[model samples]
Target: MKPFNTGHEELVHDVAYDFYGRRIATCSSDTTVKVFDRNDSTGEWDLSDSWKAHDASIIKVCWANPEFGKVLATCSHDSTIKVWEENIREKQNSGKRWKRVATITDHKGPIYDLAFSPSHCGLKLASISTDGQFKIHEALDPNAIGSWTNIFETNTLSSAPSRQLQSSFCLSWGKSRFSKEYVVACALEQSYIYQRQENGKYTQTGQLPAHGSIIRDISWAPSIGRGYQLIATACKDGFVRIFKIEEPVTEGGNLQVSLINQFDDHKGDVWRVSWNLTGTILSSAGDDGRVRLWKSTYNKEFQCVGIVSAEQKHDAIED
Candidate 1:
């Protein structure tokens, strides 16, 4: 792996690659956001731009589709989310830069995650905060140059009163064009799935008891004409859990869900889980500082197929 130096004085919280995977954006605890562009010929990454993007520590960054131009969104501990757009100059020598287009201020606490919807969904995004709020925003115009209005918000405070101290952490939008718009959010001790209604409002469709502790991350697999939906969640309980949502035959029917698999091999707090583009392989990382990959066999049983550890060997260094 080629290391690219990000001159932030604090820890980098998150990094996101553009839809084309040619550029990357990173947010840091130093309240700055930096963008890097890959050199197509040299295969090296060069710092393209850096700026102070937030008033507090920036937690997450997400890129919009290339069809929408070079746009990005960032959330921070300041309890605010901002959308930025890049102005590309035609002249090769002219400099390109990003400017703040819109700022959303509704969440009462730190925003942990932000995700842009699939290109087919138009210009929409979702964010979850530590105040137990899940919110959705939609761009007024297709080009995303207009204002973004908050279309929906759900409060999960009443769902787990016993774990009030541990608020919502992560969320992911379902990437299935075959189904209606859906988003899954993981809070303190539970996960909730919301679906858009015919009236253009979002309502909670289902709830999954995801973990005993804080649910750190949630990822909805991309469904390519799949009959069902799959969601992967990582939790402080040291386990990664997968849930399946079955499609309903009739309109307005409740979604059916089942726990398909759970793995505790992380041995510590699991932080993130992601699925392959085809939704066939799964990967996870945890406090153990190791990345593990899981795959399914013919019997539909999920097992750990590979691992990359962070441990160092003193004997090998001495030799």
Candidate 2:
């Protein structure tokens, strides 16, 4: 594999690719975010823009749908989330520059992860924080820029108030175009599924006992009109687990969640898990510094298909 230096003074925390994979954005502990564009002719990536994005370490960056123009959302340890828009000027030398559109300061602690909804979900964004809060924001008008409304914010507690454990760490939106309200969040040792209500509020619909330790990452597979839902999660217990969510038949029914498969091949904390475009394969990485790919077999069992070890130290990789 070809390796490219990011030129960050500190460790890079996260990298995100645009919908088309034509542009790449990377955030770092250096409090900077850099964008890279892939050269169509030479097939090499070149730095397009670099700027200070936050006062503290930037944790994550996510790209919105191209239909909404070139937009990016970033979360930082400064307890803020910012949305940026790409502005193209007429002057040749000016080229393209990113401008901050909106800044959200609802979280009282460091924001761990942020994600934009699928294109079919309109312009919505979700963020999870160490303050034990989960928030959802929507663009007031999709045709208008920089106009966002704080839609919802609720405590990330699936258990009773007395049993509140640790801060919520990670969350993932279900990629089903048919269902826009499904999201899964993981805290200390449990993962809870939340579904948006008709009144624009979210309710805890289901819960999955994830791991003995903290969960680092979670990903929901894209359901292209599939009957069931699939979710993959990585945890500090050095394991990767997949769960299947089956909906009840009758109207306004509850969800049925079951563990489909799990892998303990990683010897250290598993940091991230992602599903392929078709939702057929899964990839995971962690402190072991190796990327493992798993696929389902004809017998309906999941098995490791391949492993890619980094030549040097690498933190995470996405599909």
Q: Which 10-residue window of candidate 2 scores lowest in summed lDDT?
A: 159-168
Residue pairs clashing in model 2 are none
Q: Candidates' lDDT values, in order?
A: 0.84, 0.84
Please give the lDDT score for candidate 2. Answer: 0.84
Model 1, TM vs. native: 0.91
Across 94-154, the per-residue lDDT of candidate 2 in tens digits comes to: 3338889999887888888899988777799888877568888899698775877888787
Candidate 2 has what TM-score? Answer: 0.91
Where model 1 places Cα greater than 4 Å from the true spot, the runs are 90-96, 159-168, 310-319
RMSD (CA, Å), candidate 2 to true, equals 3.7
- Model 1 scores what on Cα lDDT? 0.84
